[model samples]
Target: MGSVTVYGPPISTAVSRVLACLLEKDVDFKLVNVDMAKGQHKSPDYLKLQVLSLPSPLLLHHRTPTPSLLVLMSLILTAYADRGNKNLLGRNGGGPAERAQVEQWLEAESQSFNPPSSALVFQLAFAPRMGLPQDPAAVELNQAKLAKVLDVYERRLGESRFLARDEFSLADLAHLPNAHYICSAGKDDMLASRKNVARWWEEISTRPSWKKVVDMYSAPPA
Candidate 1:
């Protein structure tokens, strides 16, 4: 626990994901805000890390990918996992196979939940920041996508409280940011209407760690 720095914009779901894990584990870490608002990700120093066999974002389809949050998740889960705290994986039968299955579902959640949800954020916040057309259609389309994702969650919740097993696991923690963001963005009724999902979210969102992140986002950015 020397110092773990997350490089990203001020209000990114990826950063918030890491913050959720840190808060859950009760780890004291520092937040090194790499202001993407000022385009620091394109700097020479940052670029050199990739060119010199460092963990740089390789150009993808001629466009670089965004800052990765998986790295942060890796760090947190690795640190937190232990023989005594094995419940985080899956108790009563958290064998290797179970962990692998848990990982798969969590990855699926990340892929499926993030795209449209983040797009919604772009419409509501980023597009306007960059002087883009945050049109009604764009917003509605992204929201529609999110509504579908929530339906999936609602179905899953009918079976269990959390996503990965009967109890909370990395998958549930991984989803909190996106789900919470959706709820906070005036989509609360949509989430609340899904009885099981609403109850599930209410329970997870109340966790001490998640509460810290929620507090930061309680006030909408002006």
Candidate 2:
């Protein structure tokens, strides 16, 4: 098996999300912290790994080149068997219909949930910590956007136990990192205001994998 290395900051929700997935799948990985504060992620060496992108927490599979499909299948089977969770995104990921549903919610998390949630966290938490001014307009805008997104979640969750279905899937796991930070930032009311959403959040955020990540990386109180 090739080595798996994750490159990013410990506190970054994006990095934490990947970590939670890896942990849930019981994959052995190496965490290579990139100091964004020192602009290490922007260095030429780091940029080469990421190519033309700036997203941190890049996952690199280290080994001699081989058939991509075989590598992917092997990794998936190994992780799925180790964790015994059939709903994660691999060989055990379910049938076509279920897989499509999971993909849909995963897309929602990346597009709808992440933008406003991440923006609010940045405006309320990271910006101030970095000595950057918080823009009231941006904060208000993102809050409203997140509220709308949660409204949809509330409706959907009322109909189903998990986002994609009754089963716990990657769709639900996708929300943990940013949701943790946002809740800690004092906007938990956004989740609590929606009964089903709150229930769902409570369930997913308490998983052992996420608990470990939070224990390791959550910021201290101001």
In angstroms, how far off is 121's CA in candidate 1?
Answer: 1.9
Model 1 global lDDT (CA atoms, 0 to 1) = 0.66
Q: Write the per-residue lDDT of candidate 2 for residues 36-139, one digit (tens) a residue.
A: 88988888887777634645467776633222322333454454564556676433667888878888998899889989988988988799889999999998
lDDT of 1 at 39: 72
- Model 1 CA deviation exceeding 4 Å by range: 45-68, 83-86, 129-131, 216-222
How well does candidate 2 match the true structure in TM-score terms? 0.86
Per-model root-mean-square deviation over C-alphas: 5.9, 4.4
Worst 10 residues of 2 by lDDT: 64-73
Per residue, candidate 1 scores C-alpha lDDT tens digits across 1-222 of 354544444356666777776666666655545456577667776555343432322221112223345654655556555522345556743789768767877877768877887777777756766888877897788788878988988898898777777877777877776667667667678679989888988888898877877676544332
- Whole-model lDDT, candidate 2? 0.78
RMSD of 2: 4.4
